[model samples]
Structures are given as structure tokens and as C-alpha cells.
Target: MPRLARPVPAVAAALSALALLVAGCGSNALAKQPPFPRSTIQANAADPSEKPITGSPTTGDPVDPAFAVDKLRLLDPCKLLDDDALKELGKPDDAVPGGFSRCSNFMKDKDGKDLSITVEVGQTVTSEIKKADKKIAGYRSYEQVLEGSACFVSVITQDEPGLAFTVQIGYKDGDGCVPGRKVAESVVALAKGKNASRTAAKGSVITVDPCALPSDAAVLEATDKSPRVYPYGLHNCSWVGDDAEMTLDFRGGFVPKDDKFDSKQTEIDLGGVKAYQVQTTTSFPSCTIKWVQLRGEDNDGEVVEVKSAGPKKAEFDRCAKAQSFAKALLPKLPRA
Candidate 1:
């Protein structure tokens, strides 16, 4: 999953609002926003005519069947970072789920230096594969070191022009690539043995395909044009039209509050549920509506977000469009 904006450490008002939101909420939750600096990984162009190792599913069979998008989605990311598998690296902390498709394990070396290992599955891999300079467990791999403190090692999983299983390591005291590559190797081995665990939560949004949520008619009503679907990571989907776009995101994070977005948010009722709406014209005219779908422990929970945006020159009510889109989607969500 992509990271959110940097968190403010001293938001007293935000915390106060969060307390009110979670007053009677039950446990079951979601969250994200990495503690480290953003990675500098960039994609490089690959030869268009060069055939991908994982052959086209339409013309032939995929070489790596286990890495297929469907199979990869069901595998629990936290389980992939097994303690036994990472024992050689250092003392790893309990794995924490960042989102549906990402997890992180924080560790300390014998010398007491900090290291963080994060694994993300089903990440879009396009031109990045062109830089695959090595191989891990028969899969083409790409490795890059950033400022000697962070490293990213990714293995191409499927070539429906691409998707990857990636491992990122942040080790300020030593060469991050060494541990990064080791973790990548361990993940590949675990995947080969079918040892990666799967999510067992009943009625989990993790199992639902985001692209399948909004119907064709609802999409047309929202964006005013035929939709082109784009699924981001495993939990977010977007419907793009000629002049407008709508996005639906299923995420785990702190309870939504008025001060969270740096703009005044209005509280609104959505089929008996409390929801927040915020409009921003910083880059373009857009409106966002978000509400808690399932409450988790503390102030965290699963959230459903709907956003609608259009070019500034287009004359339309963005907030009303977003509200309408959210109302249409609310009934389709599984009950907590």
C-alpha cells in the first residue's frame, strides 16, 4: 500500500476528537504510515519486445502459478515474515500488518542497531523488471541500495505485464541490501514451500476485489462517463472517466476526525452511520467522504473512503457527487 502524508506528532485537538469517535467502539482494526523515510526506488524502461519470463496467461501458462494475483492476495503478509526464517538476521519484533498487502517487522541487531523489514505482495511491477540484475529462487530479481541506509529487493511474480513480491530493509548502521536480499530469499523459499499463511477472518474486505464493488451503472452515474477501472495494491480501486474520477479505498487506520485533513470537515449522516466530508481545491476541485466500517482495538478501525474529483474548468458539485457515490456503495459493504 502507498504511504499516507507524514503524521503530525503534536495534534492535541486531533487526539481529542479521536477519543470521542472511539468512545464506545469495539475491537477489530486497521492502520499504516511507515516510520522511516520514503524510498527512492524508480522504474526504468525495459525492452518492449523482450518476452517476460512468466508467459502470458492467455497465450500460454504462467511459469509461477503460486504468484498469481489471486493466490498472492490471500496469503497473510505478516506470516511471510516468519521468525524462524528471519532468525539469522537479528531479534525481530512481532510482525505488524500495515495493510491488506503489506507487513513490517522491526528488529535490533546484536550491536543494538535498528533494522526494519517490510514485505509487500502483489505490487505493480512494470519497467522495474528491466533492472533485474540477479535471481532469487529461480525468479528474476531487482535490487537497489538507497543512500547506503535503505535497500529494496523485488522479485517478479507474474507478467500480465507485471506484479512483484518486494522486501524493503532500513538499516542505518550497515549495508541494508545484505539483509534485504536475505529476507527476499527467505520469502521466496517460504512461498515455494506453501508455508505462507492465509487470512481466515470471515467477511473480510481483504478477500473482496475492490474493482468488483461498484457497478457499471453506479460508476456512470458518479463520473458521467464510461469507467476505466484501476486497482491499486489490493485494497484501493479507482474509476476514471473523461473529465472526472472516483476512488474507493478500504483501509485500516485511526478514526477519522475533523482536524486530520488540515481542513474543516463537516459531519454528515450516512444511513445512520456518522461520516466526515472534506473538500479541497489545492490541486483540483475534489471532495472526500470517509466513515468507519468496522471498529478495531483502541482508536483504529477499518474505514471506507470515497473521493470524487474533476478538472477545475468542469462545472459540477464535487461534494454532492462524492456523497451520492458513497451512498450507493454503503449498501454493498459487508456488515461488521
Candidate 2:
């Protein structure tokens, strides 16, 4: 049996809005910004003859995620499951290319409602098994039904210490976990290692773990109090001080935009990285800092914020507080 570790934190307010929107559970009107657009990038190179095939050619056969999770960096989810594999799931449609982290498809039931399947590659840890309900394919697995809305089956793969690739299914009726497990199993079977000979070394800015981004001392120096950690969400963790709250968000899907803010935007520097500062004074006093974490190929963004209100209003400049936290946290981000 594999060991179980702690679960990766849930999506913060920002990502929770995304999840809800994607799940068809709510309207996105109140979301901070529009969801990141789906990626249309395909994997094929024009001339197969020009480039040499590296690694064993993908057999599309099941390999244990414990051994192949790192290879997900290269696996295109749309191509991962072939047509025949989709057929087994009841007339599977074409896979919908999602954001960098997800792929999806759907089939209709007798009544014509859609039953959807989605695969996501994201931050996960082996210890998540501690919170799982059962074992599937030698890994700890979780089965959940969102009542009438959807069902989910998640497996903690042995990729990195805290990362897992997941398969989720949603339907209007019956046990959604039934199909969720089926899709989860197929995803496991599809997991394969890339050829070392042909695969080039690549790095990802999205892989940064939020929980590891700030030290206790840094949190203290920035907020002047002890911090609390909220592991599950868009922000890696939330630090709560006696008078202020801070959130560190690693935006894997959407970059920050100036148009999203009704307030003035200020540009600043954090550990040599260019960042923008926004102050929100309407609802309450708060500050938000957004910076580019990975540019060019990935075009990803990162954000940190500090907000104080109520009794502490007279003590600090919220924007300055946010900047101080951003400064303290910037040195900790990956520069390369």
C-alpha cells in the first residue's frame, strides 16, 4: 500500500469561482475576472519525418501514475485517450481542450442530458490518500457525489510529493461515481512515460507550490502576526494576522488584467520582477499585487494581497501593507 499524505489545499475564492463556473453550478457575474480561455494549441509538429521520435512511442497502455505522473507535463489530454477508449464510455465525443490544466468530453444519456468526463493535471500530493475513501489501481482514491449535480473520483498518483492528475465525471442522474471511476481507470491506463531520447527538458511556472512559497518568518515580518494556512483553493495559503489577512495566489490559468480593476493600478518591482498594485477602497480597504511568474511560452501570473478593515483602519496603508508582503514574498518566487 502507498502512504497517504496531506491533501492539497482547495481553490481560494478566485479559483472557487472558476470551479463553480466550470461545473455549471452558478453564474460568474460576481467573479473577480473572466475565466482563463481554453488552450487551442495542438501537439503535432508539421513534419514527422524531420524530428526523431523519442521515448518509447506512447502505447496508450496503462502505466502506474506512481511512476508516470511527471510525464503528464508532455501528455496532451485530448490525444491521451483514443477513439476506441472513448467508445467504451458510451459514444464519447471529441475531447474539449481546456485551460493548460484540463481536458474534457461528454456523452448523452437516454433522456439526452449530457454526462461529461474531464481530466485535469494539477498540484497534488501522495498524502491526499489519507483523506480518500477507497483504493483504486493501487493508489488511494476518493469518490464523491454532488447530489443531483455531479460525481467525482480522484486518485492520488505518485508523481511529486504533493501533486496528482485527476479524472472527474458529471451526470444528471444515477451514480456519477460509476462513470467517474470508469474514466479514472481509463486515465490511469493512459498514463505513460515519454521517450527520453525525443523528449526535451522543460520547466513549468505553474508547478510552484503555494504552501511552500512563504516562510513563517516572512509572514511575520510582512503581517506582524502569526499566519493561518488555507491549503485548498486558488491561493496556496491564507495568512491571518491579528489585524490583517493575506492571500498568496499562483494564477496558473489567467494573468491579471488592468481592465478588471475599477481602481487605479500602480506598477512596482518585486525581486526584479515587474508587478502591478491595485487598491480597492469601495467595499473595504485592501490591496492586490499581480506579477508575471512565467512569460513567453506559459504566460502565467502570480498574485498576493493584504487587506485590513474594521478596527485596524487607522493603522496602515492597505496598499503599502500589500506591497510589503509582496516584497517579502517576491524573493521566494522562482526566477528561472
Alpha-carbon RMSD, each predicted model: 8.4, 12.5
Query: lDDT per residue, candidate 2, 217-306, as tens digits?
Result: 766765676654433221345566667666665544333344232246777776676677776665456777776555333323333333
Alpha-carbon deviation at 269 in model 1, angstroms: 2.5
Q: Global lDDT of each model? A: 0.65, 0.49
lDDT per residue (tens digit) for residues 64-164 in model 1: 87765567777777777889767788787666665566677766766767777778776656666667879988889998665645677888886554667
Q: Give the range where candidate 1 is weakest over 10 consecutive residues by summed lDDT.
A: 35-44
Compare the candidates by TM-score and give the number of the best one: 1
lDDT of 1 at 18: 28
What are the per-model numbers of colliding residue pairs?
Answer: 5, 19
Q: What is the lDDT of residue 258 in candidate 2?
A: 45
Model 2 TM-score is: 0.61
TM-score of each: 0.76, 0.61
